[model samples]
Target: MSNNIKNIVYRTLSKAWATLLEINYDYRFKDGTWKRISRESYDRGHGTGILLYNVDKGTIILTKQFRMPIYHTNKDEAMSIEVCAGAIDDNDLPESTIIREVEEEVGYLVKDVKKVMETYMSPGALTEKMYLYVAPYSEEMKVNEGGGLASEHEEIEVMEIPFSKALEMMVSGEILDAKTVILLQYAQINDLIKNRE
Candidate 1:
């Protein structure tokens, strides 16, 4: 390794991510002493999404929403079943994002969203990462639709699929989305949503 040829990791002085057809295009800027190099790197963005699992009833709350990106390729296959998740809004905490999104999308307040795993949502062209979690809840917890803003173009529909049925969906290709499949199987394998009180 040459001394001058520093393999220094480019630090983002500032950046902005625009949602392009349900994907994030993050533009970041790195500052050097001599000049600024706008390095284009994939972040695999760190965001939070939760799988609401009910142990006593063995059920998991989910959402049925339309995804534009998939619809573009599939044409007719736009709507999807997914766990509640959203990007970590600029400088916003993952916890905050989950709490807010839960209320807005599926109407749940996930208190202890146990960290499940972190992985890239897509690795080929775009740089995006996801922090998957399990949000445990019961009758005592608050769950209600927060009604998305019409001005922002959000039309989210909520669904409560049984744990077994959710698993079936994963196997039968009904719940084909990556995050939804991952969370469902992960819960089943870990016994996170077993029928227990």
Candidate 2:
């Protein structure tokens, strides 16, 4: 939490976890007049996270997992070609949540989690914050036989694909995760990714 965030006026407009609406009242100093300003009511939502890594001899490790919401929209049984990501659950620390999610979705421990980008997943009406994390592959990283816990009812598949192929997938529009695109773009700028040949 930064100093700027410590004093933002928060007023609740609606109450719902999925669609929490609120307004931030701001007091601005303008030409000897203290003005009371307000922005439109927006929803507050849990944040998203991501993890990226390179491994397996020029391969970028990825996950092929099932997403019920995505499957519901596309009318597909399983949603594949997703990056390792998850939503921050109920006050869960961003680092810890992403670490757990990365392990569950891809079966590996990522090192050097770096905060890449933070933006709204959907800002039109639904307020979802997305945090992008980048990591380097370490030799000690191992993939154990683990899908998300059955009680949590998660079924994930882990895979490693050549970096070039991963870029192709992105180009062909196979990788559709919102956070994935943002992270991939950041990786490209930061030279975490190899140029596509």
By lDDT, who's the top model here?
Answer: 1
Q: Write down the lDDT of every candidate, Cα atoms only.
A: 0.72, 0.67
Off by over 4 Å in 1: 1-45, 195-197
**Residue 159, model 1, lDDT:** 76
TM-score (C-alpha, index-matched) for candidate 2: 0.71
On residues 1-197, what C-alpha lDDT tens digit does candidate 2 reach at each position?
14222235766665654544455544535344445555554555456466466643556667777777777778553567766777788888777888888777666776558887788776765666777787866446767754666777777676667667777788988888777777777776777766543
lDDT of residue 124 for candidate 1: 61
In model 2, how large is the Cα lDDT of residue 164?
72
Q: Candidate 1 has which clashing residue pairs, if any?
A: 44-127, 44-128, 44-129, 45-128, 45-129, 107-144
lDDT of 1 by residue, 63-128 (tens): 777888889998566888888888786788777788788877776665677778888876664567
